[model samples]
Target chain A: MNYPSKLIEQAVLEISKLPGIGKKTALRLALHLLKQNEQTVEGLTGALSRLKKETRYCERCHNLSDGPLCTVCASPSRQENVICVVAEVPDLIAIENTGQYRGTYHVLGGILSPMHGIGPEELQVASLLERVKSAGEEMEIIFALPSTMDGDTTSFYLMKLLKPFGVNISTVARGIPIGGELEYTDEVTLGRSILARVKYDFGG
Target chain B: MNYPSKLIEQAVLEISKLPGIGKKTALRLALHLLKQNEQTVEGLTGALSRLKKETRYCERCHNLSDGPLCTVCASPSRQENVICVVAEVPDLIAIENTGQYRGTYHVLGGILSPMHGIGPEELQVASLLERVKSAGEEMEIIFALPSTMDGDTTSFYLMKLLKPFGVNISTVARGIPIGGELEYTDEVTLGRSILARVKYDFGG
Candidate 1:
């Protein structure tokens, strides 16, 4: 598209670099920004700049943090004895939102995707191993990764590495989601559900 | 979504305020920015701030411009006597990209929409009328707007106001799009095509 100004073109170019945004969508966004008040634009830019400049990685869990450790890792109430492993900070947030898990988390940054040149070396695999081996107390490592091939591969690789440590390794359950219709459920999930069906028990 | 950090939450809130973007998409975009280098984020923010803070509108036609007059309006090669009126700058860009018209453009900024509380005063309608009335040369005004109700209403309103002036008035043609299949075309478009069919000449 022939943008009217260099500034608009530059802004559109930068915005379109985002994951799902395209040039047209970027142009729309830029035009919308142009229509907004100067303070709104300043606030947006300030927030983005602060987010990029002030953000840090948790030393222990590798989650996004404003300091050396993330909130979960810094919290005394969180259990370090059982660490739930996730692929990214958003996954950690998702698990935290469930409010059922009391354990600490280990963020792998991303799963192993060989096609994308993302392997164990590129991830936090070695650091995770070091954490597990050096811990004084027994820690149960739970793989909270997705059920995708990459997630399974990463979990298996970690499990193989941790076999000698004698620590309990587990994974989150895979089945049809609650309130999901049986007819609408995918075949893989349906098959897994049947294989891992729970025994029916009536209430007391 | 329950964001872990106040910075992330604020950034998400600001980003989500853009048209068509929602909280989840905003979170994804914010996290993507968090993972980028500081320079990339700075470039985006700088471009946005410059676009919002330094951008100006053309005094003659209300088009987005860096100076008092827009590039088209200031260009000597552009015909000032024939003006193509559009709802926004993007429409002007679209027409320019077509490479079919060499006339100047008058951007209305937006079409009339009473439902959204937009009226003639909210647009550049008065300025457009002043330009038409005070022009040193006779002019032909071509209305290039969407076929929406608001676009039609705004065009008709301007037409009625310009009736006293002997200046020629016209509208961009509307019918089936080029290379479009008749079978798959919508009913309104098909009916309009039949009503507005152009005269066909077999040979010159």
Candidate 2:
């Protein structure tokens, strides 16, 4: 980066590793930190360090957690009989924040991307199927995936497997404002999308 | 911020306090972390937590340092007779990276902004004056301040106080490209700017 000091360069490199932080933004961030008081700078650094140490992943749903299971998974009020399957933890959080959908969740970790070498085996689909089977006839699994091509592929694969178990299989409706991320959509749209869910029709 | 969780809201508030980061960027950052692997997310949080805890201000120059003096101040190779005065630690770093100059530095911490109630008393100008007065009668002072209004005012005030001391005073010459940042300038341009420096003279 042609930075003046090793420390500054190191800081810039670390910051640049962050998502969406380009070289310019990294330099700006490092410079911003340098401009602040020592306490402020140190506070941020300390928080970053602790984030690595204190946070954990929920073993049950693969979502971020403070302890063994995530807050959502552990909550008794949530409807465990209904599991909303999503591609990532952020989507789960977004869905939870809308105050709609009191169902529990299963984070798929990622969608099926054959080109990226991410197939059903690479994702948490097997675990989700197992969850459906283990949770017995009472459980219902809703595929709340993005309507992207890979997302649709993942849903089809999951639907084919879950059909034998006979647990209810549904998907959030497709008319969700083209190219919009459910995570960024407001509560009203997201709630409507959930309310307008459609049945999965596997080829007879 | 009306976040779904208390910890997420607190963390977002803290992260957004960094310069130029707003609510949207904070949310994006939080989501990015949520998407990353547990170890990466934890590492970032841990670093934030320890950022302030493990770092301290250099006793002499007030630059961020793990020890008493910053790396630059601690280096014995720098010219002891010439002290470059700058507004922030990042500015000092920018100069050091050129490798063309071997002078030490004094950070003013910030500029004088009376409109925002930032006066000379708020800056380290007094400390700088003290450092210069105690160093030596023959010591030279270089005003490597920015071309901003505040930088001009600061350098002007310092010149008056420093002139009576009879030390050779100078400033880095301009024409490096109007309004361009010293940090972003190529080494050749920065070197040329430093080489073209002229003696500081208040209009007699």
Candidate 3:
């Protein structure tokens, strides 16, 4: 669509480059920015620019960090022996939000996606292998990656590599969601949940 | 949710301040930006800053503009005697895209909303009156505002104020949309369409 101002057109074009945002939404956002105070717009731009310029990845876990190590990797209370393997930082954050897991995380950056030209080398596989090789015999590795084929492939490849290290390898359970109904649950997940069902424990 | 990096948290906070963007979506967007190259992030921030700093409103019509006059107001082909009053720049652009109208526009900035503390004094009502007073008797004012209560109130208020100018006043027709079916159409709109039906012309 034709824009009244060249500046607004340029702003909308740049905004629409982001994922899930279209030209119409970008235009609406730009117009909204125009209505806001100068300080508000400046604050938004400042925060985004600082995030890009100052943020770094944890050298150990590959999670976003302000310094060499992320808060998870730096925390002493976290169980360093148990590393939860995730496809990305957001996945790590999701697991952290549950508050049940106290283990440290190893962010893979992405799963193995051959279609997208993302192989084992494209991710943090080498760093993960280095960590596993140097860790103690009691170290446990938990795969918290997606249930997709790419995620499974990445997990299998890593498991095979880590076999020689003699560390315990496990994966998060796949089942119906907490509030999901039986009839609506997909067949594959339902079947997997039945096959992996645990013993009924009487104590809470 | 706890973020791995403080910079990511700040970026998410700023991003979620935008319309329709929640914390989860903001985190996703922030993570996506982190994955992008530094130049892409800089380009977006630059465009947004420039849009806010450089853009201006047309003095005559209050439409967004790079200079004193907008493209529509500056165009010689546009009819100066006819004015299409709209609620906002987006509305004007929507009507312009149709290519059915050749008249200039008067942007009200917003409709009359007492709940939002927006009234005649907050909009471009004074400027519209000034323009109407100076124009000739043949000048016509058309209301192309929304069909909502606020839009109607603004149009009615303006119409009453412009009555003494002896200019012709009218509003855009309200009817069923081009591809709309009568069965699914709302009762009020369908009833209004039947009441406002025009003579069917065979020759196109």
Candidate 4:
């Protein structure tokens, strides 16, 4: 049968664009919206509008921020001398949810994947280095980057570049099943990995 | 610890307000936005913005529309002499999907749920009666409303009101489970219900 009004079709088309939502499911969602109270539907629509108008990124850590610096960067009690490097912001949140780590974070934007055309330039690696250098020679860096090969490569590269400052460089313990996504792993295992961290050697 | 930023917190809060989304899920969604490229994140944000700007209610059917009349109302070939009365837009879509019925529809908005303070006034029942009266004596109305108590109440009310105009009043077959949702039952069952519909008795 022919589709409903163009507006309904448009709603279905747009919803289908969401992750894992197909045409059938999209139509179902669109119709569900029709059944909801006008106020509830309007609320959802309003939220979507505000998402663009209200949100921005933290310039310093690349975490979502409403201001120039992220909240973590503005905080006084967190270890300013210790920065934990991570592959992405989700990884940072996973660590934060455990309520264990008190250090600040550096979101790399992504892992170094030459195959995907992702390089150091694509990541926030340069900003991280700049932040570390400015934080001082006494600062120790922790490469809490993911356990993937690309993550290892990124960690190794950062370690070598920072060796001139004679700062401490350590990577999280590796028995984490290489290529495993850190966000899905349990906190106990992740904490154990952090405690069993190993030192990285650079020829500098 | 202090939050990452007010913008991030607000975004998370707004996300948490969505159906089935909690604080932790909101955090995950917010972090996902941070890790994504600006273009990808903006795409989702852009879609959200368009959700409200482009949709409105069709005055004729009270269905969500981008214009004054909804898609079903705008169609030319649909039968005007017959109207299938349903409780919601999703029910309308389910019937439409079967490709069996060719009549136009009137969305009742909801069933008559007195327990929830939802009555005929809250629903589009008045509109259904008005449409029936306006459509004139030649029209036939098949009550495709659900089998729940509220459905029965709504159907009885509509039958009596529409009967005065000499228009035919019919209802969909009723083996539907008591208090069952119209959205989940299979197409075959729904169509069977329509075929087995019996005449309503007005307290003989």
Candidate 5:
């Protein structure tokens, strides 16, 4: 489509480069921005630039942070001996939203996908091993990664690496989620759910 | 959801203020940007800020422009005697996409909508009238506004105002769109199509 102005065309092109945004949607968004107050546009651009320029990853856990340590890693109340390993910041956020885990997290950045040239070195695997080895007391490493092949590969690799260190290694349970219907569930998940069923305690 | 950093939170909040974007989509977009090269992010932010800061409206047509005149208004090939009146820049763009019109355009900024406290004075109605009055030769004014009640109201008011000027006025024809199924067409449009049917030229 012919744009009315070069500025508009450039802005739309830049915006459309984002994932899931098309040229039409980008044009719509640019027009929406043009219609808004000048201060709002300035604020949006300012925030975006600041985010890209200043944000850093936590030195300890590799999670996104404003400083060297993320809020989770810096908090003294969080259990230092327990670490929940996640793939990315969004995954960490998802687990944090549950409000159930008091333990800190170690973001691996991504799983070990050999097909994509993403190996253990591409992630924070070395830092995780270092953290587990240097600990004076017992450390529980919880694998909260996805149930995909890459996730399993990473988990198995970590298990072998930490075996000599005598650290307790565990993984998140995979089963039929609460409120899930059996009929709608996939065959593999349903079969695994049945095989991994826990004992029901009637008398408390 | 709990954001990993203040910068991410601010960026997501700013992005979500755009039309059709929600908090979840904003978060996803922010993360995508974070993973991109720093230069790409800088380019996007720079383009957006420049668009908001330097874009202008054409002095003659009120369409978006980099200078005093938009590209359409600046072109010498366009017919100066004919003017297609539209509500905004998007309408002009839609008409331009047809590649049929050779006439200039006059953007009214927006149609009169009393419900939204928009009046003739709030739009470019006076400027449009001034342009029509200043024309030395005979001119044709085409109404390409929407078919809604507000559009009709504006058209009727313009018709009354232009009666003394004695200029030829027309509107776009209403009919079933090309490739549209007759059965799925609305009754009002079908009736108008029947009433406004043109003669069939078999020899041509």
Candidate 6:
């Protein structure tokens, strides 16, 4: 599209570089910003600049952090011995929002994807191994990655490496989701759910 | 959602302030930006800041421009006596993209909307009248605004004000879109199309 102004065109080009935002949406966003006050635009730009320049990764888990450690890693109430291994910081946030797990997290940055040139070395495998090696007592490593082939491969590789450390390794359950209809569930997940079924308990 | 970093949270909050962008999409965009290099992030911020601070409106048409006149208004080939009146700069751009019209444009900035506290005083109505009055010869004023209640009200109000000036005032045609099926067409549009039917001509 022929933009009326060069500044607007440049802004639209830069905004369209983001994922899921096309040229039309980018134009809309730029126009909306133009209508806003200077202070509002400054606020957005300031936040984005600070987010990129100042944010760091947690030294222990590789999750995004403002300092050396993330809030989860710094919190004393979280169980340090149980580390939930996730593929990225967003996954860690998703699990944290559940508020069901008291364990700390280990963000691998990415899963093992040979197609994408991502191997075990591309992830935070060395740091995770060092973390487990330095532990004084037995630790638990839970695989909370996606249920994709890449996720399975990453988990298997990590399991083999952690076996020598004598740490207990487990994976999050895979089955029909709560409130999901059985008929609509994929065959593989349904079959796995059946095989992994536990005895029903009536006692509260 | 509980963000792992305060910077990420702040960025998300600011980004979500944009129209149509919710917290989840904001977080996704923030993470996407975090993954980009520093130079890429700088490019976006620079473009946005320049778009907000350096951009100006055309002196004649009120369209977005980097200088005193927008490209359309500054062009020598466009018909000076024929002005297409639009509600906003985007509408002007849309009409320009059609390549069918060779007339200049006058942007009203917004339509009449009493509910939103917008009126003739809030629009560029006075400037439009000044331009029409200053014209040395007969001129044509075409309304290309949306076919909404506010658009109709604004056009009606402008018509009454421009009638005394003796300019040939007109509006864009309202009809079913090309390639639209009559079976599913809305009743009002179909009825309007029937009433405003043009003469069929085979001698092209």
**After superposition, candidate 6 runs with Cα above 4 Å error:** A202-204, B202-204
The DockQ figures for the candidates are 0.68, 0.20, 0.86, 0.24, 0.82, 0.90
| Highest DockQ scorer | 6
- Candidate 4 residues lying further than 4 Å off, grouped into runs, are A1-3, A20-59, A134-137, A173-204, B28-59, B66-68, B163-168, B173-204
Angstrom error at residue B129, model 6: 0.9
Better of 4 and 5 by lDDT: 5
The residue-by-residue lDDT of candidate 6 on A160-197, one tens digit each, is 99999999999998889999999999999999999999
The most accurate candidate by TM-score is: 6
Q: TM-scores, in order shown?
A: 0.90, 0.67, 0.95, 0.73, 0.92, 0.96
Q: List the residue pairs that clash in candidate 6.
A: none
lDDT score at residue A135, model 6, on the 0-100 scale? 90
> In CAPRI terms, where does candidate 3 land?
high
Among all windows of 10 consecutive residues in model 5 chain B, the one with the lowest summed lDDT is B157-166
1 or 2, which is superior by TM-score? 1
Better of 4 and 5 by TM-score: 5
What local lDDT score does residue A11 receive in model 1, on the 0 to 100 scale?
A: 89
- Per-residue CA lDDT of model 2 for A55-132, tens digit only, reads 567777877777788888888998888999999866887787778898888989889997999988877877787787
The C-alpha stretches of model 3 lying farther than 4 A from their native spots are: A201-204, B199-204
Off by over 4 Å in 5: A176-183, B183-204
lDDT of model 4 at position A111:
86
lDDT of 3: 0.93
lDDT of each: 0.90, 0.75, 0.93, 0.73, 0.92, 0.94
**Each model's iRMS:** 1.2, 4.7, 0.7, 4.4, 0.8, 0.7
True C-alpha contacts between chains kept, each model in order: 0.73, 0.23, 0.90, 0.32, 0.91, 0.92
